[model samples]
Target: MSNSASGMAVCDECKHKFQDLKAKRSFRFIVFKINEKVQQVVVDKVGQPGESYDDFTACLPADECRYAVFDFDFVTDENCQKSKIFFISWAPDTSRVRSKMLYASSKDRFKRELEGIQVELQATDPSEMSMDIVKARAL
Candidate 1:
């Protein structure tokens, strides 16, 4: 079994063949629960290499998602061609200033945010992704 930074464990013999693995690229999905329904905002491309939170904020809408997930594309040390995906999600403390309450009230902004989140996921293997896994990661 291999342990990830998020404390997730996966026991895949094929994935463990290599000792070293690192993320070559990644994308962030921010999820929000509004009106009892969950929505998402996906940040697909960063404006610059090593973009900071400020850059992310500029791209982010005034509102925030209660949950977020980061999907990373990792390459094996033995063969760069051999790759896999790792997903990690988090829930931030938004009690201060009532971040959720301060969510953008603009309909257009919400529409755009939802659109971004609806973009296709970066998983190479579609079978590996499922709503159950996503829900588990959100916890």
Candidate 2:
């Protein structure tokens, strides 16, 4: 990852650092449970370059058939491409604000704030990304 993209390096168990393989780019996804349903959001390259959340969300499955995966043309180099998955599940209590009662009322803002996970593990991968989950956070 570029110094400006990720900002800095961090450890695996550490939510503050993100480590990607020699791959020119990196991607991260944080999942939240909204109204007992799973609402996934992209966390990698969070504040980096080349793609927008709308563009990333576009790649997600539209069928609502348990998953949706799409690839963005957001390639850093000819060899570097980044994409994310947003999985949906039904359950009201399965949300980001599940524990943060202070931010519970502000669901949207709270969900966005609790961005601390990798891509959805259960999402159907038509093209296996083999993505190694990278934690994204600031410390």
Candidate 3:
């Protein structure tokens, strides 16, 4: 998406990669970061289909802000296998105020580029996006 009020444009590669994840299942998760110097959002890391949720979370810097989309697979109570696309905004408490504000302002526009996200999460810490919480939301 174009940088409007947020002053942060999402790079072309970021949108292309997100399409690969959504339509081709090329990735299990993707982590995005803002390049402050360029004032643009770019793909930071990607998780393969074999990677675990922990792997995805590990890509997030503990003291930074990031945007991520996770393709979560889970089994329903009826034993049906299901999957959900989760869009997560990760802004840890230790991150700088300017970074947090930038991420917050740019989140909606960034999320809109990755269509088909079924769930959304805003997390300041690991607990908020823990497996238990994600599983519950997937249900």
Best by lDDT, which number? Answer: 3
Q: What TM-score, over all chains together, does every model reach?
A: 0.24, 0.21, 0.97
Q: In candidate 1, what are the lDDT values of residues 1-139, reduced to their tens digit? A: 2122222222232122111222233233222233322222323333333543334334433333322223332345554543232321221233334433323232234332222222233221222234444333333
lDDT of each: 0.30, 0.29, 0.93
Candidate maximizing TM-score: 3
Clash list (residue pairs), candidate 1 = none
Model 2 poorest ten-residue lDDT run: 130-139
Question: What residue pairs clash in candidate 2, if any at all?
Answer: 10-17, 28-44, 33-94, 33-95, 35-91, 35-92, 36-91, 36-92, 37-91, 61-68
**Candidate 3 regions off by >4 Å?**
none
Off by over 4 Å in 2: 1-25, 28-49, 65-139
Model 1 — which ten-residue stretch has the worst lDDT?
13-22
lDDT of 2 by residue, 1-139 (tens): 1123222222222223222311233433222222222232222223233555454444444332221222223344456665433322212233234333322333333323324322333333322322222112100
Looking at candidate 2, what is the lDDT of residue 20?
Answer: 30
